[model samples]
Target: REKEEDGLETSPSKAECSVWEDLTLEKARLELNENPDTLHQDIQEVRDMVITRPDIGFLRTDDAFILRFLRARKFQHFEAFRLLAQYFEYRQQNLDMFKSFKATDPGIKQALKDGFPGGLANLDHYGRKILVLSPSIIDRYTLVDILRAILLSLEAMIEDPELQVNGFVLIIDWSNFTFKGWGLGSLAGSSGAEQDGPVGQMWLAGRNLPMSDVEALYANIPHKDVLQAVRNSIPDTITANLVAELCDFVLIHSYFRFGDNLYLQIGRTAMGTHMAPQYANIFMADLEQRFLSFCPLTPT
Candidate 1:
């Protein structure tokens, strides 16, 4: 069938074929606007930076390893380093998560049964991976285990060249979902809530935590301590909670526009970036309303 499709003389020329055949090259051009040599040199520089940073570990010379951080920070060396450092720190703080996690693990398998988190069978138009999660499918299980399952699945997909260059999309199905499933009220006592008021805004999807797990973690942490810690990280002029809310936004500029459901689109910014600040603000506003309505501000 593929041969038949390609056999037509009306088909694209050799140059066009080559262009489509090598998506990595196109991704580099589209996202970074850099030629092959330039991208290679930049990757080398980023690799060197990661190696020299005494605070970070598991730093590899591999293109994929370096590109993850570089793409996440839009190739800004300092910003990428900060995010990379945070990634390591977060993993270290949660040691149990990385220990022997694999896609075939039983916990992950069971979580799959719950539809706790599921990866779609296809990529998006740009060859990026698509991950779908329906909160309605969650069963009576611990959030951490479910999160581990999801991460294991994502880790399995991370090495795909298409996904590496193009990145991923996360679609959260809010249809039939309510405050109970969202666990919004649960954020009040957590340290994150004291600072950010909700987990939805506290953590970036890929950078720090799985969306659901982070949400639950924020809901349950000691709010007072969390608030103070987040406050210390920001300038004195901004309210700590406000700063906390904006922090994740600064890290992740692309977000889903909330309406009947939520659809979030993300890709490598270093290539061609989408800076949807206005959409993010609108989404944040809707999120705030949800928090206020479902999770009222009462003394935790």
Candidate 2:
């Protein structure tokens, strides 16, 4: 078939054909159900869906902008529409972040310099971009600042059609950080005891406990093992699958920084975010359950 029928031909050149061949359009068709024949039709359908929605007021209805959401959601019109709505809604709700959203903004520039979410030059095995993030950097900047830096990186990256299709891989390095850094009180310190709150009371109680003692309690539970445990424990249902996908999205896109270089946390989940503790607890529960089931004697 000619380039006109397949919708790959933009210009009449042999070089363009070679470039298209190297692109992931074939993969998109096979995996994401993207049809070059119905590409314009799909875009129009999503556009019409957007046009009818009075709630999603004044969104950019251009082909390029609308196509991104469609590509992200694998050409599913409703899912694409929902994602588009959420995209605009997020921007609308967080006006402060988007009001002066630019590369030159001081906070964003600083966050980028600190490598809060650093992009790797090379793509991964699957041709997806790899972003590195350091949770320790989170303490240095406001959540909004860090978010803006990430958004900036993403905005620059999504321009590539290959990236739009292949997406991204985030690696969050949890190293070079402490419990106190993660908002948890120090395990052995008067500093933690000085603070006022339930956290302070809890810290005061455990202040005498040595760090070695804490480490000894779960030193055997490796980070990779915990992730595997979580994966295995999730039930195989539609809701469960969605939850699993969301979790995977979070883990895969996470990245971190150390010194001047950025590193990917290949082993364990980072501390700092609320989700980290929950993720740890879920896997821990799974591990405990497995141990109890395997043990012959029941002991309290």
Candidate 3:
């Protein structure tokens, strides 16, 4: 069939045909980008490659897509695989370096004295544990779009959801704050929100969170919006309670740690990366409006 497809003038032997099949697979694997539509191929393509052409699917790469692909294979969690791959790469590199250590230059020797004091390798268990703790949620676009999508997702939950459970949860790890905005500066302690505000926003897609989990997916997903949407989706009667508690917690935690710079950092620099008074404000505002309109005349 393959030979017929290839349109060979004369048929090759069985061995040659098999070799051609192997070569075709190799090319397909190596030239993954040659066909843009190839990425849309089902998981079976990946599974077939894994079994018949391990070199095709498992070709080494540290890219996020590769990490995601591995996770989707049902082999193990992506973060765990990431850590293991990192360790494996470390082992290979270090082993190679040690083998060549005798001949390395004096400057290089000095730089790596005692296997290097200032490398990611020196990080302790606690630090490594933190690094592997949370999966990355990348919402790669303008902060405005991220915010809008989040807002809408919360809105959709009510317009959607079997359980009618209006729980919008945002789990912000410290990295979200540290995520250097595309055109935003990187002075080590900067937050993305400091540069802009919700005013004059063009569209709400990026800013709004998706109401349905099934609406979208994780690749470049604005997972941050999920929490924002939920916060905004809450009823006004309960909105004040939520804000009071969150704001109070921030103040208490801040005062305990940094003393006076506590309030100064609010709305300007995030305490953690993703923490935001603006987010709290908008959510509560939205919720309050909803409650005022819908809340029963008889108070609960």
Q: Which residue runs of candidate 1 sit more than 4 Å off their true CA positions? A: 1-19, 178-298
Q: Give the per-residue lDDT of model 2 (tens digit) for 1-300.
A: 237766764443777547655678887888788898999999899887766668656458788888888899999999998888888888887788897788889999999988878888767878789999888656666667888889988988898888888889989898886555544546664455443332344344424333433243232446556656666777766665566677666665667788998876554455644567677777767867887799896444
Per-model TM against the reference: 0.53, 0.58, 0.19
lDDT of 3 at 198: 31
Q: Which stretches of candidate 3 lie over 4 Å from their true place?
A: 1-233, 255-273, 277-300
Superposed on all Cα atoms, the candidates' RMSDs to the truth, in angstroms, are 14.3, 15.4, 24.6
Give lDDT for model 1: 0.58
* Candidate 3 or 2, higher lDDT: 2
Say which candidate scores most in lDDT.
2
TM-score of 2: 0.58
Please report, as a residue range, the 10-residue window in candidate 1 with the lowest summed lDDT: 267-276
